[model samples]
Target: MPTSIRRRLAPLLLATATIVLAASACSSEPADDGGEQSSPSPSAEPTDEPTTDATDATDAAESGGVCATGDLSFTVTEKSQAGGYYLITASAEPGVTCTLEGRTVEAGFGSGVSGDVKPSEQAEGEPITMTGSIKAYAGVNPHSGPQEGGVQFEEIIVSAHEGDMDPVSLKLPGTAEVDQPIGTNWHTDAAKAVPFSS
Candidate 1:
């Protein structure tokens, strides 16, 4: 070999080795040669849990719901005569809107009286809405039959349309008899509503 040829080949080989070393240093992958390697951090999508919109709660309130006992105020006053029957007025509290479905109300006489007064048979009727400044009432028959023992009730426990609520106790004007009493569906007109039937 000539000396000039050896010098030219040596420079070419050095340049190739430099290029190879630069590429190896710039590699973005982990080395598999038993050398320490950096690992990429785990990444995941961001979450938006534990947050709710205010409109959802408002929308639920606007939708019709069963009347809760806590939202009602009852009174025997404003009684409208429906022929020989009577209506017990029940007004809703402010900022409340609810419905009365099926047998909206049930009345039982006395404090501990469970089986004393019986609920009347009623046909399913359209739900009655009770809103702010609006009232609903149930029909009642003080005596639908003979007064066997002249049994009088001190107070009447009125249950609202809500099934999970406790019955509200309404004190009568005085101890009076309610024999085989019946009731009607809640309606806006107390005068025209008739007694409930099977």
Candidate 2:
């Protein structure tokens, strides 16, 4: 082309070349450090890979992680009489799973004159797994035979076995005529559970 045109285009060509070279140098990939790269720094940004915390949680879930107390909700179904005692059905809230091994989340009534609770004849020593809508049973009876009169209780409190577990307070369907209620440890078989003894 003409000399004037060539002079004008020369600067534009040089600028384009510089931009290309700078872009080529800006790679994010870590350069090969002769295979001697040190461990990842604590302050490094997270990558696409799963983090340690995520890995640990996954492993725990796979291995049956212990059920957190806060994640559990306990409820008492309506009370009914069976045999010679009152039966209380304890149920776990939805989406909860827990081990009853060595767990003593038991039921109790008023203190002092009202009397205390004891394990029912049916309380199971083996651990029962509670999950979802699954339920356990406890038997209670305040009045002892013909001589003992039933104690009137307005509310029933389920004691927490672990410090982490929260105790549940339930309003009785009616006055619990308890003399010395015996509560059974939570068990899968409702027949085996009995209320606490005073």
Candidate 3:
């Protein structure tokens, strides 16, 4: 072949070899799937641990039961008197019930309303004593079974109003029970409101 012809053929051969090499390289590379990468598998759930009856008991006591510990107090004040009947005022504890000697009484200040006490139908102006308590349970009818335990007060006086005597000034003695430490102000116009721990 002539020198010019040889040169032209050489350049063409080089170009074809380069194209073949590029094609081969492209075919050898892996294809992308366009899917998201998977994340690591989740860990196993925690196993149940063994617990004792004492541990359960402790939990119940600490969770606002009668066995739980706390302080509750109340002050009684007389509101008014009509036809020898005296209206009284008392306090209410949230999430608890108040009772006199386990007797469920009404809450608030008034005569014949909730948390007020009256003498028996045949009783005269006798000094009244009431033992009460508070509970988290929803109490049944006062005429039904005994009050459940949670918060309680015992032997607090519910005195009738005397002439010229201030009911709020009266101090009564009773037991105040709570499931937890409570700083609630309860007011009643009865003499001697005392609290005992159980």
Candidate 4:
């Protein structure tokens, strides 16, 4: 071949090699799909459920605790037996679980201890847990003394003990003649709660 023809063909061959290399590089590069391609993150996703510890804490707060005066409702039922005593029933409010601390309820017709009824000599029992419809009974013998005359009251104030908060005032089923009013310790059994002064 002639020297001029060889030089022209060499230039064309070099240009063709450059074009092939460029095309290969373009094919090796990744294609863009119009969005970022990255690994999914578990922490980034939103969650609606609470942790187990949190749920347990909420349940404990809703259920067990010491019984405050506000957690109970008191009702006085007049009893014809037992020398005309009043059966003071303490009922736990809705969804409350509370510990009954004292053996007796602090009951009185007046605000002071002078009007407070005394508890009987019955043995103090273990603390009772009042929950859901559970109730405790305390018997109060109005006019327990042999005095001919006594104070008349239509309502009675009741508390778990002295200094307890939110004491409830409950209307008696009927007017009571209170002299030396004596009360028995709170008992789950009505027989034990009878204020039998012996």
Best by TM-score: 4
* Candidate ordering by lDDT (highest first): 4, 1, 2, 3
> Could you say which candidate leads in lDDT?
4
lDDT of 4 at 193: 74
lDDT of 2 by residue, 1-198 (tens): 999999999999999999887776654234444233565665585688898899988876654444444444655544445435555565555765566543334556764634656544533476656677776655566455455566577877665354435666677766767665565665677766554343
Which scores better on lDDT, 2 or 4?
4
Worst 10 residues of 3 by lDDT: 136-145
The number of clashing residue pairs in each candidate reads: 0, 22, 36, 0
Point out the worst 10-residue segment of candidate 1 by lDDT: 34-43
Itemize residue pairs with steric clashes in candidate 4: none
List pairs with backbone clashes in candidate 1: none
If the candidates were sorted by their TM-score against the true structure, best first, what order would they fall in? 4, 1, 2, 3
TM-score per candidate, in order?
Answer: 0.59, 0.54, 0.21, 0.67
- In terms of lDDT, model 2 sits at 0.59
What is the lDDT for 129 in model 2?
Answer: 66
Q: What is the lDDT of candidate 3?
A: 0.31
- Model 4 error, position 8 (Å): 54
- TM-score pick, better of 1 and 2: 1
lDDT-best of 3 and 4: 4
lDDT of 1 by residue, 37-149 (tens): 33333234335542256567766766567877776788763243543544577777887778766464566566444324445544566676777777676766555664464
The digit string of per-residue lDDT tens for model 4 on 1-198 reads 999999989989999999999988776664332222343365665579877888998888666667788888888888877777889888798877887764766788876555788877556776778987778888888777775987788988889766887788888888888887788877787777778666
Instruction: Name model 4 segments beyond 4 Å from true.
Output: 1-62
lDDT of 3 by residue, 59-114 (tens): 65454322111122334322222211112233333443322222222231223233
